[model samples]
Target chain A: MAKVLMKGNEAIGAAAIKAGCKYFFGYPITPQNELPEYMARELPNIGGVFLQAESEVAAINMVYGAAGAGARVMTSSSSPGIALKQEGISYIAGAELPCVIVNIVRGGPGLGGIQPAQSDYYQATRGGGNGDYRHLVYAPATIQETVDLLMEAFDVAEQYRNPVMVIGDGMIGQMMEPVEFKEPKKRPIAPKTWSTDGTKGERKPNIINSLYIDPQELEDHVIRLENKYAEMKENETRYENYNVKDADVVVVAYGTTSRVVKNAIAKCEEEGIKIGLIRPITLWPFPDKAFEEITDRTKGILTVEMSTGQMIDDVKIAINGRKPVHFYGRTGGMVPIPDAIVEEIKKISGGVK
Target chain B: MLKDNRIRVITGHYGSGKTEFAVNYAVKLAGVNKKVAIVDLDVVNPYFRSREKEGFLSDLGIRVIGSSIKGASSDLPAISGEVLTPLQDETFEAVLDVGGDPIGARSLGRYHEYFQKGKYDMLFVINANRFETQTKEKTIAYLKNIEVQSRAKVTGLINNTHLLRSTTIEDVLRGQELCKEVSEELNVPIRYVSCIENVAKELPKDIEGEIFPIKMYMREDWMS
Candidate 1:
């Protein structure tokens, strides 16, 4: 297929359709409105379902219903909107129904602002809903990568019978870039035999519920979820290593921040500084293995983000105090520029040297 | 510089480089010592609207009119009454940076009377690399939709096709081919072939429209 320029939000909608997703339920929100709008305009043409629910809360429940019935479903919202859907997300995860949820993150403890920010890192990786449930989370740095991951998000969700998140800051939702919908690598996916589709008296009806009232049954269910999460940690962990070997300073970042960090690393290189980067593609699995690339020459680890160091906690755990971790960030919808990141890298490198 | 009419309305698909073309055309009009006012009638897209560059364009003596809401992050679909100033007054050579779809173009529907009363050139911008406008048929569908929604006929066509930093001469030519087809089909003339200077220099002179070199006003160096 020929490459065409597309905004990140529209590309996501197109990718979801290409991935065989036919049901979309979402509400309007800044930076991510294009995704729902695209789905609304195009879905009907393809005999797919697109509904603008009353609110984010209502939308996720709609997603829940569709996913339970063995349909590839999706819903998207920004930070605050994602917060509203947390309860439903928890239910989806607990029910072990496959679905995709996209968060084109904006700054927020509340309705913060419409510009890009990664403050929701904790909310995404730590599971915003109440439960011992964990789901797959993918953070793509580029629009092409965003579409590619979106195409695969459904397969991964169905394979594990778990919810999958494809998150990017508002930049990834709004920015335009050339993209081609490439087919993802084939994965071994089990049939949706566990779905609540009617049995027509041929077999016992499948029940979809997150509740296990008995304490032992609940414990067993929790352990089963844990094992699924363990499998995901083993198989789905993805990270990118750039110029990591023999570097004076290593930087860890993801999504839009990682792109800025790459530019900063290039600028540092011109000043006789060797800087390496570990870009986490999956925020959940956290890419702890990428830290092994930090060599003896590495002075310290620097984490850059659009938020004020939310991902720093994961970085600390990943490094496990093996190297000093430094942080540089901009919040309230402010994006970290390359020069600012370079200065922080210099500051960390200077202290260790 | 579109001197064919006092009011130049720029419309196209979102990401079709309509805002970029409007900014460049406004700057060129200002360069010629003409009094210019650039009205940002784009309420559909929250990001990268011409209103975001108000300060930069203001310093160049181009008056910028945008949403009544002030803050940068506010996504309210509000347009200020000041937008009508350029349309009412004949002294200013105005550039209207309209939103990119049929729904977005509806913002201009309210001012249909003013457009019809005054001499206006509604230039429909085209980017062949854009998904919806990739083919002649698709491009015509969008063009016809914009016209119906805006309640205004497209007076001119602009081949402002690009892939941002990755744009090449061939990409611009591809846009030209689509624009030429649309022009022939609709009887609207191709008015400008817009692109960055490096790519603009490589375009063949036989192309239908005049080459208009543009700077990266809306896009930043770090965007790619």
Candidate 2:
């Protein structure tokens, strides 16, 4: 189709529709309200369902219900609303239902603030909800990535019969950017192997649920989830590395903060400071092994975010504390400007006068 | 006592039930035959908000003002409301449901001059379980920062610390202690301690605030 200038949130909504998602349920929240509003307007035109649920809780459950019925289902929300949806997410994960969840994150410890924030990195990567489940997490830094990853999210979710999260921040959701919508990829027809559609002739009733009180059965289910996650890590790990050759300082970031770090790296390069970046495309199954390859060449790693050191813990763990890792960020709707990041890079590189 | 006609600024941590309190209190005050207006100044948090349910509040004869839902993409016109102009008129009581946290509360800075022209009481709600301010000292510091950012003194405290569907009397007691600490430290009165059930018998004698009971029913129509 024709390319259009779209906000990241709208791009995600459109991409979901193109990916055969016919059921969308969500509550309107800032930074990502456009997704639902767009879906509300467009879904009816295509004979799809769009529901402005009473709350995030109801919306996620509605998504669960739709996904259970073997429909391509999706939901989007900001951090606080996403927190409210965690219970449903856990249930979805337990049920092994295929669904897409988009978290256009904002600041939060509890209603932290509705500004662009990478505060939910740990929550997204480490399974925000509960139990021993992990979602296929795709972190998109640009508007184009938002569109592309959303389409990929559905494919990945179905392949594993698990929940997949398209994790972006307020910057991606709110900022206007020029984007070219590539022709929608042809998706496979819904697998008829295990869906709740009434049995026709030879098939039997299919049940999709997360409740398994049997210890051995639950253990078997957990093992199945683990194996799926292992397969995903082996086959689905993705990241972007920039200017790591002989670099003394490596900055690790993802989503919007990574864009700022990119600018900071350019500034440092101008000053003859060799600073590189490792931006994870998939936050869960985080590019830990990818980062480990460069630990020996880099002097230290700087973890940057829009929140106070939330994602730094992950970076530190990824490095296994082999190198000194420092963190700098602004909290509660305050974004870290490129200058601040550049300054931190200079400080870490010992180039500060 | 003179009729306190200042714009009441209600704020708290997330999931602290600030929106529920603000909505019920604003509607209750309006129900008592008072000219009441509520401006949803919360743009930060998303889930529990009075503005999202503007249609319901408007039915109760409460004038609801908020940021244009259309201009949500841009931070245009920081909380412009007709309610501020009528705050000086003792005939109307204005309540601004500021967003949670200091940054969310900072949007109120634009209305500082207008608030100064009339009486306004800024109330800070406290939930002891929320991060960053689970203790009294931390909560006081957060409130002070909010006070500095908005140029509005927190004149009262509301104890609303409750877990989702798991709130207990013990939680309320802990919240009460935090409330007392804030009241003494900030020299602000405890305006009300909110609870879903009536636990008036358990309240300490020295606790002076009125017990505000909240009844929240999930609408069946919305469910369908």
Each candidate's lDDT (Cα)? 0.92, 0.77
Please give the DockQ score of every candidate, comma-separated: 0.78, 0.03
Residues B72-146, model 1: lDDT tens digits = 798888999998899999999989999989999999999998786348989999999999998899999999999
- Candidate 1: the clashing residue pairs are none
Q: What tens-digit string does per-residue lDDT give for candidate 2 at A281-317?
A: 9888888876755746677889888878877877878
The parts of candidate 1 lying over 4 Å away from their true place are: A351-353, B116-118
* Candidate 2 deviant stretches above 4 angstroms: A183-190, A295-297, B1-224
Deviation from native of the Cα of residue A308 in model 2, angstroms: 1.0
Query: How much does candidate 1 score in TM-score?
Result: 0.97
Query: Per-residue lDDT tens digits of candidate 1, residues A1-353?
Result: 87899999999999999999999999999989999998998999999999999999999999999999999999999999999999999999999999999999998889899999999999998877998988889999999999999999999999999999999999999999999998899999998888888998888999889888899999999999999999999999999999898889999999988888888888998888999999999999889999988888888999988888889999999889888999999988888889988889888788333
Score residue A33 of candidate 1 by CA lDDT. 92
- Of the true interface contacts, what fraction does each candidate have? 0.74, 0.05
Clash tally, candidates in order? 0, 1
